[model samples]
Target: MRTILAAGALALALGASGIAFAEPVKVGMITTLSGGGAGLGVDARDGFMLAIKLSGSKDIEVVTEDDAMKPELAVQIADKMIQSDKVDVLTGIIWSNLAMAVVPNAVAQGKFYLSVNAGPSPLAGAKCDKNYFNVAYQNDNFHEAAGNYAQTEGIKKMFILAPNYPAGTDSLNGFKRYYKGELVGEVYTKLGQTDYAAEIAQIRASGADSVFFFLPGGMGIAFMKQYAQSGVGIPVMGPGFSFSQDVLAAIGDAALGAKNTASWSPDLDNPKNKEFVEAFKTEYNRLPSIYAAQAFDTGTLLAAAAAKADVKDADAFRAALAAAEFDSVRGKFKFNTNHHPIQDFYVREVVKNDEGVLTNKIVATSFTDHTDAYAAECKL
Candidate 1:
C-alpha cells in the first residue's frame, strides 16, 4: 500500500510540472557567424535577444547556428535546426547565397522561413514558395534606390564597384534601370579583398562625377577609408547596409557625409524606431545595425502572430506574417506581390548623433511605395 501511494504521488508531481512548463515555441536562426562575417550574425543575435526580452513571455526559444559564411555549412545548420532542435520556424541569414541554400530546405520540410536579411531574387520569382517570406528587400532593391537617386541628382558619369558575385550583377543592373548615367566603369573586386587603392585610382581616371560602391563588412571599411583619401572629390554612394551604424565604428569620419539608400534609419520620425534605438543602445552600448533592426522586427512579428493564437499550426502563422500587420522598425512597411517589402527608401547621409555616435540622417526619399522587380515573375 505504501509503495503504490508513493508511485502515484510521484506521477502526479511529474504531470503537474509538465503542465506548468507546457511546450515552448521553437524558432531556428542561422547566419554567417564566422570567417569574415561574424559581425552580421552578432548584430542579428542582439536584435533577436532584445525582442525576446521585450516580449516578456517565456513561450519562445530560439535555436541559432552559424554558417561560417559557407553554403555547405548553412545546409548543415538547417538540418540541425530541423532534425535536432525540432524548430517550428526558421529565420536569420546575412548572405544572399547562404539564405538561398537554407530557405529551400526549410520550405521542403513545410516550415516557414522568415528572412531578416539577404533577399535572393530567385526566391521572389519562379521559385517563390508559400512558406518563405523576406523582411528584407530583394538583393537589388536598395541598389535601385541608389539608381533613382543618381537620376534625380542629375549624375551623368558614375563608377560602380561591387564584390564580384551574383549580387554584384544585380547591383549594377538595378542601378542602370533607374539611372540614365553614362557607365564610366563597372568593376568587380574580390569578395573579401581589402586593398581598394587600385580601384580608387581607376575611378579617379574614369572621370565619373559620382560613384556607387557595394562593399560590406571590413571591405566596406577599407573602401570608405580609401575613398576619403583618394581626393576623388566625387559624391560616393550605395546601399545603407554597407555604411550604416554597423560599420561606422570602423570607418569613423570616413563615412561622414557619405550618402546611401535604405528603408530604415535609427533616427526616423517614428515612435517604433525611437523606442528601438533607445532600447538597443542602452542595452548593447553600441548603435544597432540594420540587420539587428530587421531581426528584432521579425521576432516581434512572429511572436505577435503566435500571441494572436494564429500559430496553432505553422501555415496559419505564415499567413498572418504575410499580411504585414506587425509595426516594424521601418515604419509603414507593406508587402509587394512577390512577398518582399514595398517600403519607402530614403537617401541617408552619415552624421554624428547627440551622444557622439555616428548614424544616418534622412535627406530625401528615393522610392515611395516601391516594389521589387521579381513581383512580375511571381504568379501571386
Candidate 2:
C-alpha cells in the first residue's frame, strides 16, 4: 500500500507540473532565401534560429525553405508545410506579395501564422485573422515615419521611388499620406532593376529637395551606388529596408549620412536589445538589421507563448500569443487590436561604426506608439 501511494503521488506531481510531453511543435519558415533578396532572409533566419537556441526548448522543430521571392513558390511551400509537415505554426515570409499569397490560406486552415517581416495592410485590416499575428510593423509604418520626418524637416518637394509591386504601392501611398509635400515625381521602377541612370536624370530635373526610395536588399545597394556616382546632391531618405545593416557593406560610402525609418535598431537602449545585439554580433559576426531583430522577436515570442499553452490547442495558443509576454529587442512591444505591433519608429542615419563598418545609428523618434491605418477595418 505504501509503495502504491508513493507511485500515485509521483504521477499526480507529474500531471500538476503540466510539462509538455507531447510531440514536438513544428514550425515552418518560408522566406526569400536565395537570389537578390537573400541577405534579408538569411539574416532573419539566423536571428530566428538564435532565439530558438536561446530559448532552450527541446520540443520545437523548425523547417525552413527558400521561397526565392516568388509568390507561387511560397504558396506551394505553405501547402507542403501544412499538408505534409503538419506545422503547428507558420512564419517568415519577407515580401508583401508572398505574405498575401500564403498568410490568409494558412490562417484559414487553423494554423497560427506569425509574420516576422511582411505586414501587408490587407492582413492588418479587412482580412485580419484571429490565427494571424504580425511580429513586425505593418508595411507602411516605416514609410509613414519617413513622410512624417520629411514634413517636419519642411521639405516642400520630394521625389518618391519604389518597385512596382503591392508593397511598393503601399509604401508610396503611406509616404504621401503623411508627407504633406508636393511630389516632384512618383516613379515605380521594375522590381530588381539594377540601373538607375534614367531615374537619376529625372530626379536631377525634378527640382525636388529630397528623394525617398523603397528598394530593399540588392536593389537598394545598386541604386544607392549609382545615385551617389550620379552626383544628384539631394538628401536621400526612405524606409529602413533600403539602408539596413545587411546591405550597408555593399552600399558603402554612398549610404553615409542617409536617413531611413525603422522600428528597431541595434542601438536601442534596453537590456533585451543590448543582449540581442551582442549575441547576434557574436554569433553572426555582423550587425543585426531591423529584419533580424523582428525575426528574433518572433522566435522569442513563439517560445514564450508555447510555454504558456499547448500549440495543439489553437485558442489557448492564440491567447498566449496575444499576451506577448516576452522581452523584445524593440523596447516596448505590444500588439494592436489587429495583431500588428503598436510600437515606436525612429529615424536612423548611416554612420561608420568604430570598426569602420557602415551601420545605422538612431537619430530621432519618428513615431511614438503608432498604430496602422488599417486597424479600423479589422473586425477583430
Candidate 3:
C-alpha cells in the first residue's frame, strides 16, 4: 500500500513539473502607425503599452507591427506574426477593413485575436469565429447610436458623409438603421481627405439640416475646422471617434457643441472612468481618446483572464478570456455570443474641460441594453 501511494505521488509531481515548463505567452499586436492611418494606430499602441505596464505583465511578450492600413501588408505582417514570430495571441487593430482581413486570418491560424476596436460586420455575421473577441463597439455600433439620437432629436432631412470604403458604408448603414429621416444626399469623401470645402459646398447645395459623418483622425480635424468656417447652418453629429481627444486638441474650440455618440467617455461619471481619466492624463499629459480607453480595457481584461487561466497554454487562455469578468473603465463590460461587446452608448457634446483640453461630456445615452446585430451569426 505504501509503495502504490508513493508511485502515485511521484507521477503527480512529474506531471506538475511538465505543466510548469510549458511556454511563455507570445502576443502579436498588428495596427496602423506610420502611413495614412498613423494617428489612430499611434494612440492605440501607446494605450496598449501603457496597459501592459500597468498590469506588470512579465510572462507575456508582445511584438507589434505596422499594417499601414493596407490589406496586403496586413496579411503579410499577420503571417510573420503567426508563423515566424510565433505569437500565441493577436490584438489591436484600428480600422474595420483592416480588422476584417486581420482577424479572420488570425483565427484561421488557431490563435486568439482580441480587438481593441474596429469590429467588422462580417465577423459579427457569417464568418464569426470562436477564437476572436472585441474590446470595443462594432464597426457600425457607434454610427447606429448617432442614428438613434438623430431620431430622438427630431431630425427630418439629413445628409450622410463618409469615406468611400467598406467602413464608410457600414457607418452610413448604421446611421440609417435608427435614423428614420429623409435622406437629402449620401456623399463619400476621399480616404484621408483634408479639404472639405467641396463637400461643405455640396452640403450647402443639398439643403440638409442635419449632417451625419464618419470621419476620424487628421481628416476629422480638417473637416470640423472647415465645417465651422463653412457658414453651413446645420447641426453636425456622429460617433466620438474622429473628433475625440487626439484630434480635439488640434481642433480646439471648433469642435465645441458637436454632438457624437460612443460607449465610453472620460466624463462618464463612473468611478473607473474617473480613475482612468486621471491616470491617463498624468501618464500621457493629454486627454485619453476612447480608443485609448478601449485599449486599456482590453489589457485589463486580458490580465484578468490570464490571472485566472492556465495562460501558458493557448486554448486554456482563450477559454479563460471568454469567461473573464474584469472591471472596465467603461464600467461593466462583457462579451456577447459573437464576441462583440454589449454596452451603453452615450450622446456626448464636445466640451472644454477644466484644463482647457477639449473632451466630451455625456448628455444622454442612446442605449441602455444595447446588443449588436451580429451575435446570431456565431454558433459559440
- Model 2 regions lying over 4 Å from their true place: 1-13, 20-23
Evaluate model 3: give its lDDT: 0.84
Q: For candidate 2, lDDT tens digit of each residue in 1-380?
A: 99999999998888777855645779999988898788889989999999999899888899999999999999999999999999999998988889999999999999999999999998999999999999998999999999999999999999999999888999999999899889999999998899999999999999999999999988898999999999789999999999999889989899999999999888899999999999999998889988899999999999988888889888888999999999999999999999999899999999998999899899999999999999999999
Query: All predictions: root-mean-square deviation over Cα?
Result: 3.6, 2.1, 3.6
Q: Please name the candidate that would achieve the greatest TM-score relative to the true structure.
A: 2
Per-candidate TM equals: 0.92, 0.96, 0.92
Cα lDDT of model 3 by residue, 187-236, tens digit? 99998888999999999999888899889888888998898898887888
- The superposed Cα distance between candidate 3 and the true structure at residue 171, in angstroms, equals 0.7
Of 1 and 3, the candidate ahead on lDDT is: 1
Q: How many residue pairs clash in each candidate?
A: 0, 0, 1
Q: CA lDDT of each candidate?
A: 0.85, 0.93, 0.84
For candidate 1, lDDT tens digit of each residue in 1-380?
99999999988888676534345678888886777788988898889878878877678888888888888988988998889898888888888898888898789888888888888889999888888888878888899999999999998899999999898888888888999879899999998889999999999899998889988889999998888888878878989877867789889887888899988888789888888888998999888988898888888777766665434466667778788887788889877777788888999999988878888999999999888888888886
